[model samples]
Target chain A: MAYRSTPLRIDRDHALRERILECALSRVADGGFAALTMQALAEDVGIATGSLYRHFRSKGELAADVFASASQREVDALGAALRGPGDPAQRLAAGVHQFAARAWHSRRLAFALIAEPVDPEVDEQRLLYREAYAELFSELLEEGRKAGVFQLHSPSLIAACLVGAIAEALVGPLSPPARAAREAGYPAPALDDVSQGLVLFCLRAVGVKELV
Target chain B: MAYRSTPLRIDRDHALRERILECALSRVADGGFAALTMQALAEDVGIATGSLYRHFRSKGELAADVFASASQREVDALGAALRGPGDPAQRLAAGVHQFAARAWHSRRLAFALIAEPVDPEVDEQRLLYREAYAELFSELLEEGRKAGVFQLHSPSLIAACLVGAIAEALVGPLSPPARAAREAGYPAPALDDVSQGLVLFCLRAVGVKELV
Candidate 1:
């Protein structure tokens, strides 16, 4: 019989792969993608540099996977918040606030995912994830429109605007220079200020007459 | 006096500097920042590569100046539109439409100015220009708020939202891959569709009661 992989070995392999991804993510979170390197990741994962090649074909592929995994978590979280129990307007507000808060808490990771300039591989993943975020919003927008809670045309386009507004509003505060400025006695706006403004702007854009 | 400069010499020098800037802008517009190089720019301007160094201290400085000059023109044009004769709401709508139309027409240049990833020098100019754009919007927003037209709390925050929305919306359509898709058989959205949607989105975000 051909050599067969045991379940124990398969499980170990899967766990090791996940551990590597976790280490990669933490590196990206601590610094931007610029800090992620194959050798560094291998060392972090406590594996041989040659072993990394077995898990990922290239650095770009690894970076793209890290970006997708992080962004996917965000998209899922936002989706749940938007689709949570409430009126359509309340749900949208909740979703916007949740997204802003999450980004605020993890400013470096958020900036890396949302606005950092990166290699073409990561950049392509960025575009795809941006679309994914927009798609989540579009579904909620459509639901709200059908419920007569939102009076906007083109859910897809409106969703894009919402994504754009959220990213742009947060990028300034999340930037390194902005953080440096805050460290230098420039008071940064509180999270509530940004969240409230973003929610109002997004709700109004969707033609929600009375914000909850 | 030690070798006083003539009026004709000064005029010629000014024109040559302008010419170099023009060539630099075209290079960026054609292929984003990656297409720009001192040697290529000198060839385009019919000057020796050494002459280019005399005109510009470094590539970064040259790129920054090109970015600033191009962005300043956009700011001036947008300022005139927003500050033109009309009520705040009407002027805001006109300004949004004008900006969208201008971006849609020359998408390459628009993408370069709005979203192209570039070196730090150009990126710094990008941030400053973005703030310049937001400042213009903030001024209009203040006027609208004072006139009891806009019901927003923070004009600066709202202005950032507007700029972000505008850039994100246009960047997708202006991206190289999007252009490739359009060339390959995809049907691009009409200019009116994007412009109308964008204008409505901005007006609503600013809490304009009756959209034009």
Candidate 2:
């Protein structure tokens, strides 16, 4: 006899999948992609190794999904800020500031998402998310250009430059050496200083006439 | 008995050391630092493994030295362009154009030096070389600021932004996927377009009143 699906079983399955993803994200956050192993993930989720395969086809697939989920959150946050209520210049400034603050607060996860060396699966996801970010900026840039708020030819290329600048500036400070220095009494750059500078630079790069 | 040093032997040793470094660099350029093993290097250089050790203390030291040497060349090239005969803005524009052109011509070596992940020893050198690049830009920015050719605070920070922008823009086109796309009949951005856009963005970011 064929068994019919039950709502309770469906709910249980969904909850288990969420729990597994949460565990995987935490593992990556704490120890980078290197820390993620199928065996370790199964143990963390209190499941047999064989059962874990039912959820994820392979480690690369699992890592890529985790990367995409994390990156999507960042893209969403940036989108909200950039599309929020304000003039184009002000919105851009606010977006930059928010992005910097979020990355600063979670340096490890930020580094992992932004610049960590990972397997090809995750790297492919990274390339896609980078384009996602540029696409968001591109939309705003097009609007600003139409409104005469920005002067530029290639919105997408300029967007990539802004993303690159933000990543580079933050990566240095968020790197292990810089963290160690701060731990050993070397003062880190204040959040305000970096955010303000980043916003100003990005605005100018996009050819915003009036300073925000 | 302490043997007197002979000039011929010294020259031969120097040449061998150079050969080892050259081989190591080529290996890195071809397959990144992961491909750079002492045994592989010795084989490429046509030397015994024991002889290779006599020249360098360890693989890490050898790798670090190769990284430094390669990076120093880039730093020197950038310095010359920025410090060449021109106004502050012109020199900066010229420097950026030259840098982009050079990196475009040698994508593999550029990728190896700029973004390749490696062991801690090489990473440390990467940080130092990045600072070296920043120092050169800082000097030029200071000159520009004093001459009223540009308006920006924190030359070093701004310098970091420029470096990041250039690296990001080029890395995308230089990436394996982008190359594959080009091979598959996709057109790459013309060098003139990229160089011009990059120069314009950089100039504006520095607050140049009259863009080049």
Candidate 3:
């Protein structure tokens, strides 16, 4: 019973940190990263701004922590798509489709984080974030190559392109218009068709034939 | 004589605007956009801050004007690439390679512009900027398609991905160590190789069996 007290105290600290992060997210979502300030976050969390330093050493550290958390959620989504039952082509398409849908929905937050460097300190986490997406595409390409379902010169290079391209799909010319069109009396498709076409283009670049 | 006087005055005004922009670029190159202020720019250009407003309505206006001018250099670059003689494949590679190099070299200013939306009035220019890049890419792809060099669902979509990927390539990851690895002795290939691969991937995506 006494040993249980240690875990409970740790949980309390965790809970408080989570509360601050949640408030930060709401602010960041409403306004871009330009609005995220430690003072504002602390006020929202009902703590002295000094209390924030105990959890995060600096504003960059706090932003990094929050970004890491957001990135992990992104990684988890890719993992689900990767783990879901399907063939290499099917899995890849489904994975990209699901990601595009979700990312397009979170465009404001994603654009703020991806377009600008938050903290140069969290760069590794960003790579981890990229690596997670890379792995999903890599495994699909590798599996397809092994099974003779795909022909590729370099699985790794192609995987990198897919990861980069698919992520780009959620932001650029297509995304902004897609968003506007979605809101302006157009029915939202279950998947982003243009994004799907881009993914298929990569698959075909690897010589995957007969893939829709 | 009176008609000539108005034209000369307009030309002088244009020249002054150009001088201010040139000074702004030099200052931004030395520091970064975040450090650029109306006051500092006024001093740097030998004009009083109040006089500066005669050329640019506000700091936001100045930045937008500066960006509009800098972005024109890219447009000129695009025109130069188009005017030179090459097949669709060669032109496509040349265009992307130059874009990558330009992006890598002017990364500081480019990062500032691409990573943030300007004040609302200027923000509309961002869409037009992206469209220009898209149109440039579309021109190459269309040339390729016309010559039976490229085939795809949409040449426009592929071009956006290529341009977007190139921009994303210039940005550092959220992790500082990885960026250090890139600068230090990492085995990663130079960005030139990535640029080459990107163009090659695009050709392959469009059903080109071999690059010309």
Between 2 and 3, whose TM-score is larger? 2
lDDT of each: 0.87, 0.85, 0.69
Off by over 4 Å in 2: A1-20, A27-66, A116-125, A181-186, B1-17, B27-44, B47-68, B115-128
Candidate 2 local Cα displacement, residue A74, angstroms: 0.8
Write down the TM-score of every candidate: 0.82, 0.79, 0.68
In candidate 2, residue B210 scores what lDDT? Answer: 87
- The global Cα lDDT (0 to 1) of model 3 is 0.69
lDDT of 2 by residue, A27-135 (tens): 9888777788999999999999888888889988888888898889999999999999998889989999999999898888887787665655675676678778888
Candidate 2 C-alpha lDDT tens digits along B12-68: 999999989999989988877778898989999998998999998888789889999
User: Could you give candidate 3's per-residue lDDT for residues A67-117 as a string of tens digits?
Assistant: 788878877888788678887777777777777777666776776555433
Ten residues in sequence with the least summed lDDT for candidate 3 chain A: A115-124
Task: Give each model's clash number.
Answer: 0, 0, 5
Model 2, position B44: C-alpha lDDT score: 99
Q: What is the TM-score of chain A alone in each candidate?
A: 0.93, 0.92, 0.82
Instruction: Pick the DockQ winner.
Output: 1
